[model samples]
Structures are given as structure tokens and as C-alpha cells.
Target: MTEKQVIYLDFKASKILLDGDFNAKLSDCGLAKLGPTNGNSHVTTSIIGTYGYVAPEYVATGDLYVKSDVYSFGVCCLNY
Candidate 1:
């Protein structure tokens, strides 16, 4: 993953792809955004993503950060 990538926003089992080598790649970046590269937060008025994958903090407030992706990734891991 690139440092500039803040979060997958919609991360889930369906969005992950594994190659023949078993290397995982994230896909469906339509909801991805270029956020704080320094690990800060980015606030937006609009929040968009899949349910259950979205962070609770982001759901309460429109603030998005790298941790939001972590939250979604955690959910995906639990599902797997």
C-alpha cells in the first residue's frame, strides 16, 4: 500500500484479490481518497462506503483518517 493511501473506505472480503503467488491486492478504489500522508485526519461533509465496514467514528462524524481503513480491515479479517 502507498503511504499516500489513507484508507480503502470500503474494504471487505469482496474487495480483496489474491494473486497466484498469494499476494493480496486491494481493488475497487472508487471510494478511496488521497488523505493525510503524515497520519493526520481529513474531515469531509460527505461519508460514503459499505455498511459494517465503515468505522464508527466516521459514521458518527464525517471525519476520516488512516485508522478508519484499519477499522474496516479489521472487520474484513474477522469475516475471513
Candidate 2:
């Protein structure tokens, strides 16, 4: 119905159901889709994420998986 609702549905379908990792947290602003903010027409297409926060496999290849996030988690532990 609303833009936010549509975006949420898309995120659910893409990141949750497809990815099968509902609890997989991202460093971004909790948005699966990268786009412009409120009243801003500049929609960004690139999926730019943090440097060390991203997984190796995901960084090497565009393919993302739960394991990739796990790798990132391990890296985070090492950093701490």
C-alpha cells in the first residue's frame, strides 16, 4: 500500500525468504535496498557496504550467503 510497506515486502522476499537468514544483520540503515532518502530523488544503485564488515566471498563475488555473514562475524570477533 505504502512505499515503506512495499519496500519491506521486497526486503522480506529478497533478504529473508530467499536468503533464509532473517536475523542476518547489516551495518547499513536496516535497508536491504539502496536508494535515496526522504524527499531525495537521487536513487543510488550501487550496493556499497562497509569495508571490513563485508564478507570475503561476498566481496570477491556478488553472491551473498548466510555463510558470508558468518565469516564477517568471525572477522568481527577477531577484530575485538
Candidate 3:
């Protein structure tokens, strides 16, 4: 985001798909927040997303950082 805050994106593999051109597409999940965060983070309460797809740190604690979304994306990519 434009401001200083962390985003915890729950990237569902069902929402992502490769087109005929083989380009990564968001499908129907809409555009995800993509930009530089300048090393910012945020925390949340409770778990509202996929369990194992999220980072372990976030699973143990509610502290969600920018890298948490990256970790989720990587996990989805690995499963892809």
C-alpha cells in the first residue's frame, strides 16, 4: 500500500491460473496489493485464511509481516 502497513494475503490456488499464453493470472480474485512496503509490518487477531498456506510465524503468533504474503505465494507456487 501507499502507507506503511503489512498485508496478509490468502492466496488460494483455485483463484490462480495460467492462461494459454502461460501468463500468471489472478483469475477472479481481483488484483492483489503489489508494491514496495519500505520494510513495514502489521499484526492481526485470529486466523481467517488457509492454515498451512500461511507462514509458521503467523500461525504461532498473530504478527503478520510483508514477507508473510511472500511465504504464502511461495507455498502456492510450490504446490503449483
Candidate closest to the true structure, highest TM-score: 1
lDDT of each: 0.80, 0.42, 0.65
RMSD in angstroms, all models?
2.9, 11.5, 4.3
**Per-residue accuracy of model 3 over 1-80 as CA lDDT, tens digit each:** 25644353577687678999998776543323343344545555565567777778878886666677788788878886
Model 2's alpha-carbon lDDT is: 0.42
Evaluated at residue 36, the lDDT of candidate 3 is: 39
User: Which parts of model 2 are misplaced by more than 4 Å?
Assistant: 1-47
lDDT: worst 10-residue window of model 1: 36-45
Clashes of each: 0, 0, 0
Candidate 3 clashes between residue pairs 3 or more apart in a chain or in different chains:
none
Using all chains and alpha carbons, the TM-scores for the candidates as numbered come to 0.83, 0.41, 0.60
What tens-digit string does per-residue lDDT give for candidate 1 at 8-80?
Answer: 6888889889999999998888888767655555746487998888999999998887678889878978985
lDDT of 1 at 34: 69
TM-score rank order:
1, 3, 2
lDDT score at residue 74, model 2, on the 0-100 scale: 57
